[model samples]
Target: MAGLISKVFKAKWLLLGIALVLLLVWILRPFLDVFVYGIFVYYITRPIKQWLSRYIKNEGILVSVSLLMLALPLIILIAYTLLVGMSQLMAVVNSYGLTAALPSGPLTNMTTSFSQLHSNLTSGNFTLESVTDITRQDWYKTISGYSGNLPLLQAIAFSTGSTIVDIAFKLFIIFLVGFYMLKEDAHMQRWFAGTFPKLMDEHNRLLPRYASAVDADLQKLFFGNLLSIVFFAIIAAVVFEGLSIFAPVPSLQIPSPILLGILCGVSALIPIVGMWLVAGPLFLYLLISSLIAGTLFTHFGYFLFMVLAIFVFVLTIPSFVIQPFMARGQVHSGLLMFAYVLGPLVFGISGLFLGAIVLVLVTHYFGIVVPEMAAEGQESHDFDL
Candidate 1:
């Protein structure tokens, strides 16, 4: 009777423990991407951190420096993309003679009003009357009707601000997670091994060995990806520059084709959609520029040919031919491609990470671990895998 009561108590606690774990999982489901990305960031920076540890004594400072270095390229990419993108788009529009869309007379008049208003404000003549006078101008009235969607614009701004905040929060979480992992990963690994000793045995070796192998391959895969990106960017830049020689109009040629090429390479991180993010906008810019300039009839053939060359030489050929060789020894080209392709098709965005992970684990286990285990594998830190 006493033993039965003890068993009942243990069962109840175990059930409660499971319930709490499930609750925790449910709470964290929304942040799965942030956590996965954090893990990715951790691995990518781990080597650098290890190297830095030789000189940097403080854990916090080391992690910060590593992350900053990693972020430098991203920050530069975004800032340059925005600054140049705006100028390029506007240049195209101006070059194309979009005068039919907005008359030059009204714009010149509007600019004069703005200049006068600025001068009045600076000279301390700022008042409702002055503002009203500027708004009352004929040119201002020409656009006032189009600007009637003030409430809608306000809502959009609010939504955009909220999204930025959410994204900022997620990035903080990702870095925080990475920081802690860098600081305490060794401790955590030791604790994990001690907490589950029997897991060292053959039946349990299945998971750890498989995981270790996958981890190694993933590291190699990422390194290979870096190399691929570099090569792709170089190749893309050259191709785009070469194609520019055929442009009938300057606007039809890519502005800073090298930067666009680098961005195309970086866009691979976006997965599934990939280079389209860079190339799509570019194609659209060209099409709109030619259309508005009334050069479409004469130049449409060039536009079509340019896009085809980009897709064939810069995109399609690289994926199947170049990248496979880049990742040759690390991952099977066919398998890697399939993972990248079918992953999104099968499971949506998360599938991008998931598919690669699953591929590594399965390939490593069946190909290596299973064979060794079946032959009675020896124990080592290698076995600790």
Candidate 2:
């Protein structure tokens, strides 16, 4: 009776534990993005934090300097660079006189509507009422203008917690998660290893090897991203410097090519940034200038630049080729590129990092664990033979 009761009690507790985990998951479903990003931040900064421990005496100061002091400025610089690059692209398009050449059609109406909205936003006279009123009018005009085209516009989708306060709160949570993770990095590692002691037993040591392999690959994946950015910076410098040699005008010659190259390379890693950046904007301006001066065909530089820019940025070498090369083949370049590309398409923005993560674990298992297991099997077979 006693043994039966013990078994029943154990089963009851197991069910209760499962229930609690489900409850927690439901509660955290909405804020999953915050936790995911926080974890990503922790992993990316882990190596630098470890390196800083030799010099910094205090844990608090080390974490702050590594994250807030250093990473913050880099983030801001990337953001600023992306904005500047976009503005230059817009300038190039405008210089083509596209707006002036446009007919008064649906596209023209949409452009005018957006222009008016921008003016209102920047005019400092924007109010809730004024903005809503403008939106309503513009919506009506846009709908009417496109009424004959398609009834494809059915619904507008929106996310919850889109207000400023909600955004700030989410950021705060992300920072809190990151801070604690960094502060307790050693503790977490110990906990992780201790959590599955059976797997770490002396006979096989499977868990230890698995964990070590996973950690090593993750470091390679994250640091590989950084190294790729540096590599891209070097390429950007070479390409821009070469382009400068044949430039007849200052506008065509990129100013501060080195700084701009670094910015472009870094910005490419950011999810929302589609920054061909230094090369894209420069090549655009050069093409337009060359065409306006009727030197596009005569100027060999223009043709060469077109080919170079198209080859480097448009042909998809950075994410596909350089990334895997820098990663040292722990992860395939094509697989990583697809993970970055399709993750967002299939699972939304958070999927970008999440996909890389899943790819890492899957690759580690097949690439490292399976091979090791096979090698051990071969050794045993040879010994028996």
Kindly provide the TM-score of model 1 when superposed on the true structure, using C-alpha atoms.
0.54
Total clashing pairs for each candidate? 2, 0
Candidate 2 stretches with Cα past 4 Å from truth are 1-8, 75-161, 230-293, 297-325, 368-385
User: Cα lDDT for residue 322, model 1?
Assistant: 56
Deviation from native of the Cα of residue 371 in model 1, angstroms? 5.5
Candidate maximizing TM-score: 2
Go through the candidates in order and give each one's C-alpha lDDT.
0.64, 0.61
Task: For candidate 1, write residues 1-385 as lDDT tens digits.
Answer: 9999989787997789899999999999978766766766676677778788899999889988887776435434432333332233334455688635532331222222333333334455234655545655644664564454444444433532335578689778978887888788889878888877787654757667766777777765544564466557667777887888678887678765765776676565445687788889888988887888888778878888899999998889888865663442346655776675455334433344567777877788788777777656555545778
Q: In candidate 1, which residue pairs get closer than 3 Å at backbone N, Cα or C atoms, i.e. clash?
A: 208-385, 209-385
Per-model TM-score versus the true fold: 0.54, 0.57
